[model samples]
Target: MDTEKYVPGISVDSNGHPSEIGIEITPEAFKNLETDNSKTVPPDGETIVVPLQLKATELTPFDHIGLNWNPHGHEPAGVFDVPHFDIHFYMISAEEQLAIPAWSPETDAAFNNYPPIGYMPADYFTPPGPATAEPQMGKHWLPGNLGAYLPFSKIMIYGSYNGKFIFVEPMITLDYLLSDVDFSANYSQPEHFEKAGNYPTKYNIYHDAVSGNTYVTLSDFVARN
Candidate 1:
């Protein structure tokens, strides 16, 4: 879309590893994120990522932010710091088939057996601050809503080789792909997350095709109860 390439699986080097978010989602990079099945691609290539997470100190330093799937600015990247609640992502591209309703609790509508992603419900409540009274990190899995995790959420992906969602090379890392959506690993304690205990969120996931990729950095992001 933006002329491709936005790698960031920790921007490794000097021995840390990862130089390009673990590249290798071939099949021409999942047929270049698709538009019309790119000729029924699948000599290998198919992915569906967006499995929420965050809590590596909530992230800071920025090449990109707000979605923790990293890589949004084309680079050997790494940055974070920004996320106090106000995340965004809705690229449901099966060439676009998301009317999501029939009892829209946030989906489980099953046109594709969903949940390759997480924490949605308008990202835990819409426009205002502290979205519906702060304290989030998980919830909403079946007509959802139980104080739905809090906010400080997560969801991004990097899968192909037939996994399911190839929305174009989206392997996450580097503070979950460029942190900082106003950030907060407790930014002045927004009630220090009221309910769902054990709060410590982190997320870095990537699983590619042509055979190359791996990273699931989420030590934890609790507060679920």
Candidate 2:
């Protein structure tokens, strides 16, 4: 997968703090996506890790970005079984993310150790059971009152590990990415932060007709104590 085709970048304020972070997906990159699930990681997915530019790494808490392509989304059956991409802006290093253990009886304690009450977004909740925690990734927190019967398209997700916020994710379906419409929305914020840094309050997805590229950006950063 031509890693260079997917560029991760950041915009900073006058003081050098990150104001926006995003990924630029070239037209060829999206058009040539691997749709065969057999070629992906076990279950049905392919993950491409892109290191943030040096400037971005120095200014923001995130170290890298992970683009996971799901040909046939895993688990929860009807809810997320469609083809989509899970964009993860990871605060942890690539090595640390890889060391995360898969869910099992032995690793139950590690995965179940939920973050303190104000650490996660106000309305997000970790689904019950050990299956909620994924290997090489972490546990996913979904909106408390999501309409289960509705079709899955796009949504912002929060990821945590061992009681700490590790990554911010935006899940977008393949069909949506192919559409002409653009999307921008404010995501819910947590009452407290474990790490002090500028955090994004909104996300955007748009297609540039001239460049024939798709941009997924996180903006409106607000400093937190």
Candidate 3:
């Protein structure tokens, strides 16, 4: 697939600070996705990782974005086992992200190293069990009682490693993206930020009729320390 069709962009405020960052997906690009699960190695699943460079200096703290496509979803089964996308707005560099070791006895401490109390959002917590941390990604924190009972569709996630927040994520199902309705929702915010910068307080998913494109956007930036 021509990954270039998936464009990553940023919108800035009057003060020259980044107000929004998003990815634009053309209608044709969505239809031509890979769906074979067996082809991918274990742990990673049938996933495609697309790295995004927004070329905006105002987007400090956040180095780039990682657009991950899970064709058959992932683990902690029955909850996120369907097709979906994990969009990671990473504050760390791609090199640092890739340097994360695979989950194992030797790397248990690293994967399980979570952020401090006030750094995490009030409502978000790690899924119960033997560390749901992913290699090269870090631990995922979800909001509310999301389990086998609640049907998976779309949700916001926060990621951290070694007591520092690294990424802001929006996990959306393939079904939801294919639908016609536009979506906008407020995501939870941490009591305090680990790094001083502009952070998105809200996220949105909308379809452009004229351009025939889909946009998953993060906006409503607020400066924090």
Better of 1 and 2 by lDDT: 2
TM-score of each: 0.23, 0.93, 0.89
Model 1 ranges with Cα > 4 A deviation: 1-32, 36-125, 128-200, 205-211, 214-217, 221-225
Predicted candidate 1 versus true structure: per-residue lDDT over 157-179, tens digit per residue: 22111112212112232333223
Best by TM-score: 2
**TM-score-better candidate, 1 vs 3:** 3
Query: Candidate 3: TM-score?
Result: 0.89
What's the CA RMSD for each of the models?
Answer: 15.0, 1.9, 2.7
By TM-score, the candidates rank as 2, 3, 1
* lDDT (tens digit, per residue) of candidate 2 on 1-225: 567888887887797778789999887767666667666542355467899888877666789998888888877798988888889999999998888888888887777788899999889988655866988888888888779425888888889888778899999898988885799889999999887877889999998899888889899888888
For model 3, where is the 10-residue window of minimal lDDT?
A: 39-48
